[model samples]
Target: MDTIASLFSFITWPVSWVIVQFHKLYGAIFGPDTGWAWGLSIVSLVVLIRICLIPLFVKQIKATRNMQALQPKMKAIQERYKSDKQRQSEEMMKLYKETGTNPLSSCLPILAQSPFFFALYHVLSKIASGDKIGALNQQLVDSAREAHIFGAPIAAKFMDTPEKVEALNASLTDVRIVTAVMIVLMSASQFFTQRQLMMKNVDLTVKTPYMQQQKMLMYIFPVIFAVMGINFPVGVLVYWLTTNVWTMGQQMYVINQNPTPGSKAQDAYLQRLLKSVTQHGEVRGRGRKRVVKDIVAKGSDRNENERRFFAGLAKAGFAAQADGTVVKSDTVSAEAEGGAGTRRQQPKRQTKAQRQAAAAQQAKEAEDATLSVEATPEDKPAPSLEKGPKPQAKGAKPGAQDAADKPARPSRANSGGARQGKSGQRKGPQRPKHPSSKK
Candidate 1:
């Protein structure tokens, strides 16, 4: 550990300078020899480093999302070349090159912080050993060595020997308790950060090795932190805890504000936009407008969540415009609310066999009806077959039985010629012969 920290000794001066500057400010409120002063100085140093690494952090986010997006393709490549490890690696590199993605970019913030972290660890070790290093003079070193955070010396570690802890004027138990608590918080924060990312920000619809790797890392990272945390000085633990907290809050902000498309966070974000648009009848913020514009641009290609957002807007009497503005649209709202364009209940399309069967059924019904009329008994009859009235029977009315049994046909116009058939065929008047043949 000493050798590893010494390898980053070049950064020790800068790290020490930043810590001393923070210590000065904190020392004013809390005595210079107190835990709050030195402890907060470590936290401030972490914040300062993280602030400078913001650009790297942003790059890391982009790389992570890009990696997620490329997972399926990567998996395909892997399957395609499983027997050829060299070729697979070549293809992977090609893919990375084409996409301009650096797999290592996801580790940028951590990689960038390592130097400072180790430098701080080295500086703290020197203080506990009663040695002066970097920007911390003997007086400052003495003060830092004497500072106790939660009854544990700031330079004392959980694994420090009892003799060494006693030399720092701290009980081993106190150091272990303080360091253990800090380690747990640090690990817990790390776990929560990754868990939230996996749970909310990632595209849950996709099942990929990328997601699997993330799930593995989510568990792996906390364990690594906890294991390594035993040897970390109290000051170093404070630095790590602060960095983890900063990372968590930073990630949360990004998830809330600019989550990946099709993610739960994005769904939540869209819901918030929908509510705001519903209340105000317009997109209020530029960020919101941008989100709406992207959704509008998706058109019918929108995911389930985006489509739901559009539906919500439509139901609320608003429609998103191409320019990202929401306008009052009674047409959309009415259609959404009233289901105005409800699908017509069209008759089911019959197959050829079904049509034939239907036609036969109708014919059979007509034949039965005709047979029923013809089979009626002759009793009580009033009309005869010669188109004359039947002999009066028992003084019955002459035409009583022949009274209209069916609807009458419509009368044809008098065209001064033989009348046309109800089928509409013309039967013109005949003259003699050729003019006569007609007669």
Candidate 2:
């Protein structure tokens, strides 16, 4: 253990330095005596490491796919060289080189993190023993000693010296409770993370040695962590737990966005996409930086309401037949065609221009109608059946006939008739004047 720790001393120094910086950053907010600060410091370290490992995670996925693609060829090589082990190994290496795929690339992320894991474990273990190591000054060590999470010091362990246990006022029960809970969480997270990769990311079409190894690691990692997690200081446990959670989330994101082809995750992704298009009228694909915007669906860009309307029609026995014509009885067809069924009618909306024009036309017709009625009374000819009797000559009787046929009367109206000749006769109203106006 000392030799291993010494070998990782280079890594331990840097990891310890960064962790202390994070601890101070959080401790300023959460207080130096609070375990939350130390716990958060571990989480910060995990975040930094995972951020750096993003490229490796992407490469790891690519290498894994490349390896999966070579599975058939790998099997053929093994069968062709079944009698010769050395040749088989050589062919495998050649194949890996030609394909630019590293057989160990899939394990690179885990392997790369192992050094940091061990370095953190060593640092925490030393801190627990009150020994200052790697960027941990005496002041920092003393502060960490004072920091307790839930009354359990960040540097405390499941097993502690009696003096140290009493100094922290911590009981075996307390240690057991904290360590056991963290252990369960760590183990369960590791188990599910590996299980997710196995179920969703791995291609099960070919059963190669690589797949068997993956399957083995899936079970082995969880069991190993459950047993070893008890010995871990709370800080180290916090680190591993945080890292596991990060890995799980990262893996899930990659699986969802760019899942391994022919895997369960891909199948699920396709199903979800199909369901999205089926339910909604729009779907989108990943754009730059995976930004997505919905695209209009093909055919009549009918929205969800229209789709539901047609679905309702289908349910009501107005389904379209194979020839694309609606197949329904006359009554149902009439109801559907006449828009008298449960189908909602969309009222046509007139534009502003149309409304204005219609109003102007109506006003013009009203004005013309009023003018026609008024003009009818003025221009219409008077009603006529026969002519009335005309006024007679001055000496004519009240009911005298025309002068051409009736005789002239010698009366007061014509009293000057002897002095007046027929041509110069004095003519007056044929009717007699009133008594007042007789003179």
CA lDDT of each candidate? 0.89, 0.74
lDDT (tens digit, per residue) of candidate 2 on 84-181: 99999999999998989997888789889888888887887777777898899888877777777776777677766657767766766777788788
**Every model's TM-score:** 0.78, 0.62
Candidate 1: lDDT of 96? 100
Residue pairs in clash, model 1: 432-435, 432-436, 433-436, 433-437
After superposing candidate 1 on the true structure, give the runs of residues whose Cα lies further than 4 Å from its correct spot.
345-439
Task: Record all residue pairs in model 2 with backbone atoms less than 3 Å apart, i.e. clashing.
Answer: none
Off by over 4 Å in 2: 161-163, 207-209, 275-283, 287-439
For model 2 the local lDDT of residue 116 reads: 88
In the order shown, the candidates' Cα RMSDs to the true structure are: 11.5, 28.4
- Model 1, span 89-202: residue lDDT tens: 999999999999999999999898899889988998999888999999999999988999899998888987899999999899998988889999999999999999999999
